[model samples]
Target: MGIIKKIFNKSRSPEDGIFFEEMRKILGFNPVDLSHYRKGFTHRSSNKTDENGNPINYERLEFLGDAMLGSVIAAHLFKEVPTGDEGYLTKMRSKIVSREHLNELGRDLNLIKWVESKVSAQHFGENIHGNLFEAFVGAIYLDRGFTYCEKFINKKVIVPYVDIPKLEGKVISYKSLVIEWCQKEKKQFHYDVFEDNGNEDVKHFGVRLKIDGKIVAKARATSKKKAEEKASQRAYFAFQEKINKK
Candidate 1:
């Protein structure tokens, strides 16, 4: 029998052992303290708590993970591009640890399967993936330490991704780009956002991007931020030729 199957055969309580095996596959090392990892997957909706009644969820871990990602990515950029200025290095690190990138990482790892949430998985927003990834990183830090956390980041984030050349051209925020372009070219721009009702269960917001007295783009998303960003992204492409010139 396979080792994972044998794990079940050998252990009376197999869930922990199964999780260890699964974690080993992703982390490339056996997890020591399983509770940290379990907390990483626990959603706030689950309403779990510790012995002292401190809420048990991934939010704290996610915060730590964000800092860890920033620290590691910043260090990698410093070493990789010795000639890069602070602005250049900061921008590069932002690109690497952007919400979109982290979300993609979580999706690639299929981290949602491990999530313990009262809410339906399908209804969870895109950020959940990124949050889980960050929480996982936090769990690694707590379970092992900075050395293992750095190693994990280097193995998963740095080695496979983090191409300085490719990242240089990557846009971390289309909204920022759009605003900068408009200001530089002396073009009047505005984002008119409003509640957009849909038949779907989730509430959505709509944003209209107007530039130089003309409605340039419109987008609807679950949040105002997303809706605005989507409109900005569309506007960026619409004015791509003009925006790239400056």
Candidate 2:
């Protein structure tokens, strides 16, 4: 009986056994160090700390992961679009790693379901999905090195969604595009932004986009930047023909 109990003890650890299986499904391979992956899902609200009193959360890992993703994407773009200039390559990479795209990827993987947080997940902002996704990438790099990191990204990100021709016309930032077009066409453009507090829980900002001293578009959003972008997008559509000609 003692020998039987000893054999049972040597089997899968109860603490991380199920988690290991779930991670295997996501990663397509068994992870050697589960701690890294745990950290990837840890939230700052947990108030965890390392032995050295440093904060133990996914923020640092998110930074590393962002860099890794960018590097890998840049490399792939470089090889795939040999004729693409530096500016063109940069724009393509930005579209691939945009916050919106990252959020979509995270939601598709349902990564937020694994987060260990003291706060309720509903209280978390939309960016949490993208942040967790980046931290996961960071953890993969630390656990299995660059080769595996590249493989995972290529399988999950590049192969599935990165279509060069489609991405070439993708507008990651309408605000930037509008500004570029205005500069090239020598048009005088101004964004008249003001606080537009209404009967809402959150304060909002309104923006009126004027091109060549004429009101092209007006919009309101929760923040100034968002309001400006919203106005710019409307303005872009309004002047799409002229802008496209340029």
Candidate 3:
């Protein structure tokens, strides 16, 4: 039986064996469905499809992983912060699963090294890390079920970083903070966003944050939302003393 098992293992592809070992090291367990994980790391640009003609990529898995992360975080927050109202718990959960936090987790795990993409990895944006992380979570959930999914998230996310006190003070959205401060101060504020005619492959949006008809901050990013947020963040720092007093 031992010899037979050894021979069976020898018949497996070397690349698959290495991938399985690496996945075991990262996931803390052997994966049942390696295909799911492969799909998780697959970029849509690869243009892969299953036998039935359905697309095979990480996007669907990313969606599932997002939901799973939210569910686990929400449950944990509900139990840990019994005094927290629904609004408070929801906000806390959002902070835990924010894109920034997710990107950090993915980068720490070095998940991008395993991604299968037609485009160069360097060309991919920052959000790719977070997207792959979510897809990996979805693959885990699909391969091992909810219990394993919860364990994985707890080990990687909650146990290491979900400190209630720290999270309470964490700023998930600088844009929201600036908007709230403006409303409280009864100051008129607006984000004037426009397409930036930059010589780049990707389109960029430029944003000028106006507070009381004065341009307080200007910033640019790949998206209008990001541009506005960047401008808002700069504005917050510029007016930190005044805003914090409120």
Candidate 4:
């Protein structure tokens, strides 16, 4: 048998009673159709196709969950912050649905314990937590419909974590702030990123944030996006006083 098939078999071998009970506790209600919930936790690596030969995994569900999260959060923000303009509302929504926030939520729920993947958990990046959380939301939407979906989100996300005052000050992306600052001030900026893998076991990327040909900050991380963001953070601090004054 294929390695993926073997992994799928192992993943499916868990007791339905135990899994259902665990899901019930997390869901705060009994699930109707268990298959949708199962699909939410299923990873693409399982190589399991449905009776219709459709690829079964959490990815498509993730898309739905993302949209659901945005809309729900947007509505809450709209009702809560009536004075907030479009840009303010948009920024607030971004902060609330930020990947970091979602990852934190997933961790709080201990959602990763149920994932079925051929790849080991440790091998999975931090984003896996957020992705699983989203897929789970999608599953809730599918299994119970939008009313239940909204309730679950409110219970898990809004009531516990949504603090309007706190979210307003949160910076989802320092890189975005830095870029916006540069453009508003009509300054030329660049992120010179390159592979920084050396003798280390893991690959890395290095970035230098330059403003008008002057290196303002430098950073290195596992990915180019992270490296640039880190460098931008440093640069933001370097110009914090000036940026803030503007």
- TM-scores for every predicted model: 0.64, 0.65, 0.65, 0.63
TM-score of candidate 1 versus the correct structure, residues matched by position: 0.64
Q: What digit string (tens of lDDT, one per residue) describes model 4 on residues 1-246? A: 453453244444358767777788888886666788788889899998989999999999999999888899998889999999999999989988999999978876778888888988988889988999999999988877888888899998997668665567666778899899899989999999999886543568999989999999999876798788778777876787776889
lDDT values for all models: 0.85, 0.86, 0.86, 0.83
Q: What residue pairs clash in candidate 3, if any at all?
A: none
* Model 3 Cα lDDT, one tens digit per residue, 1-246: 653454356655789888888888889876776888999999999999999999999999999999999999999999999999999998999889999999978876779988898999888999998999999999999988898899999998897668676578777777999899889999999899999956544567999999999999999876788788778877877787776889
**Which scores better on TM-score, 3 or 4?**
3
Model 1 weakest lDDT span, ten residues long: 3-12
lDDT of 4: 0.83
190: Cα error in model 4, Å: 47
CA displacement after TM-score superposition, residue 59 of candidate 2 (Å): 0.5
Indicate the residue-level lDDT of 195 in model 1: 97
For model 4 the local lDDT of residue 220 reads 80
Pairs of residues at least 3 apart in sequence or in different chains that clash in candidate 1: none
**11: Cα error in model 3, Å:** 5.5
Query: Which tens-of-lDDT digit does each residue in 99-179 have in candidate 1?
Result: 998997787677888899899997899999899999999999998888889999999888755656557667777889889
- Candidate 4: stretches off by over 4 Å: 1-14, 170-246
Cα error, residue 225 of model 2, in Å, equals 29
Candidate 1 runs further than 4 Å off: 1-12, 170-246
List of clashing residue pairs for candidate 4? none
